[model samples]
Structure formats: C-alpha cells, structure tokens
Target: MAKGKHNPERKAVRHGTEKGSVTLGGRRVAVEKIRVRSVDGVEIPLETYQALQDPELLTRAALERMIHGLSTRNYAYGLEPVGDDVESFGTSNSTVSRRFIAVRQLKST
Candidate 1:
C-alpha cells in the first residue's frame, strides 16, 4: 500500500494580530497573521494582513471562504461526498445564528 506523505519538520502556526495599521487609502487596519518558529526559536510572522473595516463584510468573506472550501472539497471531503454527507451538518436557523455569534466571539477573544 502507498503511504501518505507528511512534512516531518513542519512547524506549528501561532495566530496573532497587529492593530493600528494605515492603508494606502488612508484607512486604519488591524493585521492578522500566523507566526512560525525556526531553529533559533525566533517567531516569524507570515506576510498576511488586510484592511477589512466592515464587520459584516468580513463575516461574508469568511462564509464565502467556507462555502468555496466545501465546493472545492478542501476539508478532505474528497472529490465528492457520500449521499448523506451534506444533510449531516445541517442545522436550524437559531443554531446557525448562535454558531455565527460564537465565531464572532472567537475573533474578539
């Protein structure tokens, strides 16, 4: 059998944000990024940070990423799913709303 390949020396990522950044459009932004440690134990922050001022816009963008990921089967959902896969994660409106709130809380925390 063919064994799955993995990165044995891959470093873990640490999430953090740097606030009070100014954009080219004269808008303030809070940067979000992940840090990785090298041999010297020096944390190198990834070059990732964008100015997203609108909360609803950020929420929509995140949801879009999730939906796109599902469509692309990015979560190891395989090229496709079994018959009942989609139905399995189904939730009611209130449940979904609560989950959305929880996700927002995650950003705040």
Candidate 2:
C-alpha cells in the first residue's frame, strides 16, 4: 500500500523502480518494483504489481498447508528449498502460528 496507491485524476508521466523483497512459490526473491510517475515525479506503483509483492504470500502458503493437514510444526518442511546460498528463517512452528493468527485477525477486522 505504501508504494502503489494511485490518484486517477493525474496523468502518468514515467516509470521508476522501488526495490523490495517478495516470496514467490515459497522462495523469497528480490524485486525491482515498476511505478508510474506523474509529471511532478510522484511515483505511483501499479496495483497488480504491488499485490504480487504482498508479504501475506508466506502466511497464505502456510495456511494452505495447514488446511491440507500439514501441521504448523512441519511448516518448514513444506517450503521449496532455497539452497545453501540463501539464509533461511521465519519457518519455525511458533513463527508460522503467529503469522496465521495475524492474518486471521486482519481478515476479521
């Protein structure tokens, strides 16, 4: 939401980058965000593009696994291996549980 909110009354003048990280297919990857700039140079990210970068991706993946009978304790085992070069974290049982609860709370609100 921080990067991509747009004002339709304005005209898009150019494209710019907003670097960030996002998880795709269970692997966290770096991304260069594409944004539309107004004549005054105010960057407005594309809604669809920003949605692809939502951090809830990991939470949703964890929830899907839970719905399919994978316990939170086994969450890490469910992710696609990112190899030795990538430092792995955030897949612990407690972390997954917390993420699931957070998402539920957000949905309720």
Q: Clashing pairs in model 2?
A: none
Error of 2 at 8 (Å): 21
Candidates' TM-scores? 0.25, 0.57
lDDT of 2 by residue, 1-109 (tens): 3568775665776685777666765545666666688677887667776676677788788888889999988887788766656654567788889988998898999
Model 2 alpha-carbon miss at residue 108, Å: 8.5
Tens digit of per-residue lDDT, candidate 1, span 1-109: 3376655665654445543332211112333334466545777644533333434443443345455653222322322333432222212334334545767788899
Pairs clashing within candidate 1: none
Model 2's lDDT to the true fold?
0.74
Span of 10 residues, lowest total lDDT, candidate 2: 24-33
lDDT of 1 at 67: 58
Candidate 1 residue 30 Cα shift, in angstroms, is 2.3
Error of 2 at 2 (Å): 36
- State the lDDT at 60 in candidate 1: 49
